[model samples]
Target: MSDVVLREPAHRVSPRAVPYWRLSAAIGDAIVAIAAVVAYVVVPGMPGWTIVLVLLVVAAAVAHVVLMPRIRYRVHRWEVTDTAVHTRSGWIGRESRIAPISRVQTVDSRQGALMRPFGLASITVTTASAAGPITVDCLDADTAREVVARLTAITAATEDDAT
Candidate 1:
């Protein structure tokens, strides 16, 4: 019922996030590349056109692995203000979400196996919104913990029932 004007968040994710993203992308790409190779080898007397297609797929995968991380690093950002938490994310298309402090229900931090090697974590803020929780990914582990703690304090201090 209300118009929400959105703006960019104030802080970029950790610089280490770039490499973390790159490594993640590379792992996926590697799997794709391997599948392509297996297909080529398993199919006996494969057509020349099929070989060309496989090479194209491999090339595209390589390009995605190389480019996506840098683009994501530039686009992902977050800011926690006295009244709200805001986030911007996505590599190809952008998404921005904001949760008022009074509406925050829970704040959690987590690190996946892949993220731990890079000392990175993600923070999820559960809010009383139909759209679902908002997550700021690839923060430094300590920063993520601090953010969770700060949000807990802010939301606890608010008088709202967080419904």
Candidate 2:
């Protein structure tokens, strides 16, 4: 028999974002809550709507409690090496990307109602091609902005160097 093990790279930086489940649960809860309210007002006397609304609320609540805390994530790292910016994402199943310092077109950040309470945000790095937009959701708002700013600066510096 043989045993094998793997370790995280020594230089890897932990992402400054909340778990995906947390975001998902919050979104689920919000939608369910709104639906519940609508059901109550529009179909309060109907047993089926009431039961469905209650079930949704219970399911969302359970997911929020049981699953959100168990999920994990890591933000993509921006190496900003001489020629490229490396962006990686994943927890159990990992996906990685590298953009030549010149290829990054824009960086954007977003915060939703659910994320607002947790003081979290998302940063999306866009390339010229539509298919290449790399989005890292669940980052802290300020941290997301800082990361974008740094990438922008790096992109600009690389452009200057190229010229």
Candidate 3:
């Protein structure tokens, strides 16, 4: 191999992914909002601040549901190569990881109910290390499958050398 290192460009998931993220975030926030509303309604003589607090909570949740997906999409990226799997993800704290194909023990592709509607899936690449699996989320379904297949083949080739 040449001394020059290879790097992959960053990429975002499908644009349709925004709705899936929004819906999931909204659903969780709605559950919390509903419980808060029930408490306000059922409790006798609740403090006036409770009303203000609930409204602020809901506004913040709405803002998150509307905004976080775009941020997440922008930050997440993955690439699979014969030598390694590279990923960068997360918003609050960004993480970049590179797992050599020789270290990969398994690869999987999974889709949730929300992801299925948008034809999105997530790819997981597992290594023997304690750091846990690396995941590429919100990929196009076909692309996720292809990545899994390619990673599997690449890892398999290294098994003999590892032994």
Candidate 4:
């Protein structure tokens, strides 16, 4: 078998993605904070140390809410070339994927309820790899559509069975 090498993708996600990621992180952090508060309130006669723990949790949540989005914005990137699609994503731990055009099976785009407000979308490219589909998140909606169309056309033109 040949060795596989990874390289950085050439394009960054939409600038608007930063706010979208911030909002997403904020929502999840809010849920965690609320749960911690509720647990602290509902559990009476809790140890004093538990209060410290709750405070620590809230603090961590706040930090994640504020910092993660910016980190992710810097980390996330994607590129589509004539032969392959490359992507880099995640904040805490980075991931990179490359899918050759000949191996592409399908391309799909999605806009969730939260994404609609931000005019953001995600594109998923199914390939013949065992690692599962490659997804590019927080793209501008129109860009996502264009990417999907382009990938579809490219894959359609290929002679492979995508096996």
Candidate 5:
């Protein structure tokens, strides 16, 4: 084992926890609504836009039914402990991921047009790993900003030791 120290205080879970995909669906639902109308009006034959629309709606509904249940939307919690930043997600296959406080390279937040109505943003945490970045979506914007700031500070302090 090696010695490592924490530079900042741990963050607590947010109180306004919400579904991660609710926001995505908010946008997708709008598009689906338009598609539904188009399908109702434009389908010319027995196997046409009507069938396509039904498939799309069914697909979207099925996705929501299957995935929404597995996501622990109400239980989202994240904390920046002394040694690592821990985040938990999922409802059925509940997953927990930890990034060593020192291994964190970047933390960013993104805001979309639909997210604005919900006053939310998405956060992404990146490391040197090759699997690409991990994203945490549908966070209240302020919380997203706070996470980014905390991670950025931690990164700055440890940059010199980066390989």
Candidate 6:
């Protein structure tokens, strides 16, 4: 990290990702929170503890829906190189990763219902490293495909071919 002076992620995720992330998080949060709250209300005599728990859940949902997506959009970024994959993301506890293309095990792209409408997709690169897979979130669908293709070629070219 100290050797390379570059400060920011080489590529920021697509802007459309903000709304797409926000919507999906909000929907999941609402589904769980609303269901719990409704169940509590239907009981007629809501217990004090249940009410407090539900309220706390709602508060968490509110933050998850409102704050997280925006922060993620601002922080999330990734770059693919002939030698490595670089990424940075998260707010409370920032995380960054650098995975060499030679170690990559798999490359995949996915489109969720909400993301599809916005022409967005996420790409994940699994590697042999113990650190965990690296994800490039919220790229333009076409861009994600390009990244996958480029990374695949780079990784394949570097393979040792044990067999």
What TM-score, over all chains together, does every model reach?
0.93, 0.55, 0.88, 0.94, 0.62, 0.85
Model 4, range 1-163, lDDT digits (tens) per residue?
A: 8798666898888888888888888899899989998999999898888889889999999899889889998999999987999999998898989889999988889999999999999999998999999999989999999999898888888887888
- Residue pairs with colliding backbones in model 1 are none
Q: How do these models rank on TM-score, best leading?
A: 4, 1, 3, 6, 5, 2
lDDT of 3 by residue, 35-67 (tens): 888889899999999999889888988888988
* Cα TM-score of candidate 4: 0.94
Off by over 4 Å in 6: 1-6, 49-52, 159-163
Scored by lDDT, model 5 comes in at 0.64
For residues 24-96, could you state the per-residue lDDT of candidate 5 as single tens digits? 6555666776677676767666455466767778677657744663354654556764456777666656556
Point out the higher-scoring one by TM-score: 1 or 5: 1
Which has the higher lDDT value, candidate number 4 or candidate number 6?
4
Instruction: Write candidate 6's Cα lDDT for 1-163 as tens digits.
Output: 4587766668899998888888889999999999989999898877789989999999999999899888998888888888889999886688999876777889999988888999999999988877778888789999999999998888778865312
Best by TM-score: 4
Q: What is candidate 4's CA lDDT for residue 54?
A: 89
Number of the predicted model whose lDDT against the real structure is largest: 1
Candidate 1 residue lDDT tens string, 1-163: 7799667899999999999988888898899988998999998999878888889889988999889999999899999988999999999999999889988988889999999989999999999999999999999999999998888888878887889
Evaluate model 2: give its TM-score.
Answer: 0.55
Show the lowest summed lDDT stretch of 10 residues, model 2: 6-15
User: Is candidate 2 or 3 superior in lDDT?
Assistant: 3
Residue 21 of model 3, lDDT score: 85
Give the Cα-based TM-score of candidate 6 against the true structure: 0.85
C-alpha local distance difference test of each model: 0.92, 0.62, 0.82, 0.90, 0.64, 0.86
Q: Write the per-residue lDDT of candidate 2 for residues 60-124, one digit (tens) a residue.
A: 78666455444444334334454655656665466666656677777788888767766777777
